[model samples]
Target: MSLQAPPRLLQLAGQSLLRDEAVAIPAVKELPRELFPQLFMEAFTKRQRKVLTAMVQAWPFICLPLGSLMLTPELETLRAVLDGLDVLLAQKVRPSGWKLQVLDLREVDENFWSVWSGAPVSSSLAMSQRQTGEDCPCTGRQGCLKVVVDFCFGFPDIVLQEFLMHVCEWAQQRKELVHLCCKQLVLSVRYVNEVRKFLEMMDLNCIQDIEVHTYREMDSLEQFLPYLIQMKNVRKIMFRHFPGCIYCSPRIGAEIMWELISTFRKLDKLQKLHLDMVNFFKNHLQQLVRFLKNPLVSFTITGCWISESQMDRLFLSPSIHQLKELDLTGTILSDFNPEPFQILLEEVAATLEVLILEDCWITDSQLNVILPALSRCHQIISFNFCGNQISKSVLENLLRHTVRLERLNSVIFPVPLECYGDNFDHIYWERFVQLRAWLMEILRETQALRKPEVILLCTLPCLTCGSRASYDLEPSPCSCGKLGREP
Candidate 1:
């Protein structure tokens, strides 16, 4: 008697699990028959009369699960069905713990949208799904979700209510969220009242791991912050760039700064914040410097033009001392003067264990001045500088200086080509091998720390953060140990 097979489905998570959440879940497609299917078909070919029996004997799916994230019906239905089958088969499997938290925004309040416009927001629904004749799982609101959809996806009205409505609806269902995620979807301003209503449902202790995207509005973001600070469970808040803003200016207003600190002050249980694109104005660095004094794990300041004062606040802000990982790519190195660049390295070099600077203008000359200061930062584990204009010499020098660097990229280490074994391209391969070998020589001799992997996401924020979204923020973390590793 052959063992039975479990029904299978397809999803894209860590290991291609049967499912994950909507925000993180990718579109599902049928499993490729070439690999598993063909093998299964062949095994059952001799048993046409028992095709179903053979399928029942084979493990027929992939498992890529996101434990805490939520998913939509379309994605979840397929996953649940397959997961249910897996359970029936009693196979060795670990299904995802993610559930469906689809928020339905189908109603409207248009008056307020005319006032506030263009807010940055989450790309997915903030609250769980809504339908008529349904009672709330958390608050038991029947037949009425209180807040209706205030804006369409592309209309100007959409921008106004995006943050306010999405947050309000999401907050209304807070009791259901045992897991925290930084999330919001602001589509229009008419939903402002909806958000205002959400504040009334605040349970500071219940909020955890909030993810928010900042927008261009000078007043709107500041307006609703009071509600955010109230959520006590929020441990980490991620501020992302809104989807539409890609080519806009990289400056910010003063109100944004004040409100950011004010919000930070409220999160008592908060341990990490991922702020992206908080522009530095001369006057505001004073405030920012003050804000960084608070303890945090991770900090990300991407794609902003920092005034000298603002730049100083970063170094002076005692926050750098506490942060475990620091990402400062996508920001201008002051096309005005490279001196600030040097100052930046001096400020963050020693403290940053995990460092990322991709596609930046910091040349070999600049890094030469910067990396040596990091000699004391023995914890420095991972470092990435992909797409840099740095010369091989500068790279070689950096490898020598970073003693504990476990993970490195770009100029970190070179890979030899198999072409050396071939006859056709041996000449080119020979030159390539010689050059890369020299690079590898520096890599091995430096004996930099030896982590296995690193990621490269440091593109210019004007490009990384959306131009339309222009929701600027500074991301910070309280993570522990080193930057990244060699890949």
Candidate 2:
């Protein structure tokens, strides 16, 4: 029988792998015999003992079964113990300065969710059952596979928080990567640097997943990126940042990070790239746009827009024709003239399988031009158009054209409101009703798409009002003040 190392697990906790000294492990190794008798137990041989010793010493924490539980007569039991230990070491210990990697979750839940849920699920509705109380019908007898309810509100809670650094060693033996979550990362900037160095270490090769999320800037990232650029197995990378991420200011931001990201070209095996801000994206707009236009298995852009030059380069890239998933939200397409964007759809609309346009400046004419071309993207399964101008005629026609579109996301128009010049409170309810009727009339020709498959998310009496003119297309949060409907 052939033996294979375990797969990489996602690093979530939001703690930098290098900066968290408590977790930044030097290479795996054995402690002096005088220190731990737990490994000297007769059940563990020289190899098994070597692996066990490394786990606890590698990191400050880990999650595992009780200490003496594996003192058994079974070889299978011993193997399970050793493999888990090996994975633990792999995640924490690394060589000097060569391999930093990151991975994701789809690899972990392979068929595990089936065992957990006890039934096969295909539809979105079927998979979205997080409610509790009743025994899961999928598991006729077992109920839910795993259920632990505790109000531990923070980190090390969702993941292993105890001092069992031993768990890392156990994972190393099996040749698997450990897992971490992003939300668990709640720390100051000073410590995030530690994660960078730990990841930069060499021995920590063959990784599966690691995510480092920061609110403002990833200043420490520049140092270790060159090492990560060498990982032969890095397939997916997801970066989440908050607000403008001012680190990305005009020419300087992109000019600096461009060199760092250039290392990404080393991962000839990469399939996914998820970026979270519009600012940093602006720097590498042209190259980033071209990179996205390729055979990427999945692409998602939330609240980001393309630059003028990048939009021009997009037309030249043949990769734009092979994308599988695409998502864009709160994008400012109007900043530049909408012509290049229009030219873009004319070429790639037929190849797009998934499209999301929310809070964008989409005119009815643009939608009309793209409709026939889009009908050919037969694989389209998800379409989210929340708050954009869709001509009543095109919208009605879209419903019919979306045959393979499994999830046809309907629209949420800006709520109707009347502007009361001086006294904002005196704004009457009748004014809104009248405006609502008028807006509906604007799309009256295509109001027939309110059926079951199309999810129509509606919100009215919203404090956020609409534009006085027909041009402004910006997002406004719900401003529901203390004023209630007039009695």
Looking at model 2, residue 39 earns an lDDT score of 30
lDDT of each: 0.42, 0.41
lDDT of model number 2: 0.41
Best-fitting candidate, scored by TM-score: 2
- Provide the lDDT at 206 for model 1: 39
Writing each residue's lDDT as its tens digit, candidate 2 over 53-166 gives 344333222112222233322334344444433453444444332111211111222222232223464543421232221321222332111111111111233232221123
Which residue ranges in model 1 land beyond 4 Å of their true spot? 1-71, 74-199, 246-259, 278-286, 334-351, 403-433, 444-487
TM-score of each: 0.51, 0.52
Models, CA RMSD each: 16.5, 15.7
Ten contiguous residues minimizing lDDT sum, candidate 2: 143-152
